[model samples]
Target: MKKLIWLVFACMLALPGYSQESATRGTANNVRQPNVIVVPYAKEGQDVRQLIENNPLVSRAVSKVKEEFGNRGFTTKDFVTLLKASKRNDIISATTGAKSDPVKDVVLESKADISVEVKIFVNKHANGSSEVSLELQAAEAISGESFANASYTSDKFITQDSLKLAERALGKVNDDFFTQLQNGFNEMMEKGRNLNVRIELGPNSGIDPYTEMKTGNDLETELQDWLSNNSYGGNYDINSSDMVIDISMKVPIYDQVSGKPYNVTKVRGPLISFLKGLLTSEEHEPKTKASSGQQIWIVIQ
Candidate 1:
């Protein structure tokens, strides 16, 4: 039996044009128009503003990448437009800085499916040849998990136009990113998407997260159980304090109760209902926001 199993596995691996992966939930036939957001920076540790404002090369690089994504059928967002539209400066700061909090806030609000951060360095040698070095990383907006990374350098300087150079360099990296993106999306669908949950008690609410529940379990334990059971693989994180419970975890793409995949519009109702019953509080209101991808705020009174 062991030998037969091994033989089967080998044959499976050898099968031509066959794959074990499946499309992400809610995406049919591996065709989904994911919202793609592209942000360009000058280099590692440099603020994106430096590129967005000071460098023409960076602008060209960003535009090229955006165009490439558009050509590939992705619904792309204008990052510059987003920054300008956001009243919250923190989101803008986080986009250009190393701080992730603001980024998460923006992602949550925008609900983008894929976020791409690109860093470019363009050098013109004395021989009149230009070298464009690119470091590109693509992450799932919901989970903040990196799905693709590419570092490529343009060796042949076919054009003196920095814009053209930037475009060509990004093309190389984009190819690699798209190649890995499909598989990564499939894996994320299988594992589920991450959600950031914050639970708080109203000013007069008697609920205490650290207190014991009627089921012989503490509030934290009970909450954990509920979150885990609702999740795809019983996976979750809980940061419980005296007054608050913060949870970050993966929830199933499909809700067992509805037998349908979850999305921005459909997710909140089930979550709010489940949470209200679980807490058994007198008055509860849940707010679902798309930050980092999707965040839920539950307040009990």
Candidate 2:
């Protein structure tokens, strides 16, 4: 009888263990991976598109790095394709005398969560041997905050193939390189994304920071409260005065209402609704002056 009881107790304990492991596996499988874009690093006054097109070494390095990320199951964006589209847009805009920043346009249009810039260096010796090194820097796309950086150099080889050289250099640091990026990205996923907000009073609004709204709270206080309540985990910083209010906050990756990926446009709706309650007059209605990426600008007139 004692043996039977022992067996049942052991089975009960093992069942919970198996169930917990299954739940963990299910959660991990459901976790979404971030989209990444790889681009060649360019110095000031140097065009990245031109560099990648003209320099074989740079082109191969970019391709190899992107391949590594894609092989690891990351959704990778093709920088060359994006560059072509950006260049076409620039050509179109030139007729109207409009200037566009190509790098900024590509980065924003790609809608990538992270941007990785790659730099490659090569040295050739008189003995027909070559040495290659690469640097990888990853940053958050929306906020431009750098999170991971790694540098690796390969041993001298007789081959002149830049792709092979880059592959060797990357392979040396592959484990550590991805570990850093994964940790940084995981932290970002937990903490939410960065967003910047600017609020201003229009010239003829007849309102100031101290103006009381229907809620019986001053304009600044009301806006502050709204931001605090809306921001992820109530995380935000504010700089306020009579002229303007600047707020930096963290927003969730997914919209609470739609459960879809969130962006500046999605955040603008709730903010406009809140502002409408404060500025009832049509003339004093809130208008969004800018809504792009992680930035939102509103003016109450």
Which candidate comes out best when scored by lDDT?
2
Candidates in order, TM-scores: namely 0.61, 0.76
What is the alpha-carbon lDDT of model 1 when measured against the actual structure?
0.66
Residue 189 accuracy (lDDT) in model 2: 59
Candidate 1, superposed: residue stretches over 4 Å from native = 1-35, 42-54, 70-112, 123-131, 155-168, 201-207, 252-293
Query: In model 2, where do residues sit more than 4 Å from their true spots?
Result: 1-30, 43-45, 85-87, 91-100, 121-133, 154-168, 256-260
Worst 10 residues of 2 by lDDT: 22-31
* Model 1 C-alpha lDDT per residue in residues 162-207, reported as the tens digit of each score: 7777777766855557768766766775677787777776666677
The C-alpha RMSD in Å for every predicted model, in order, reads 8.1, 6.1
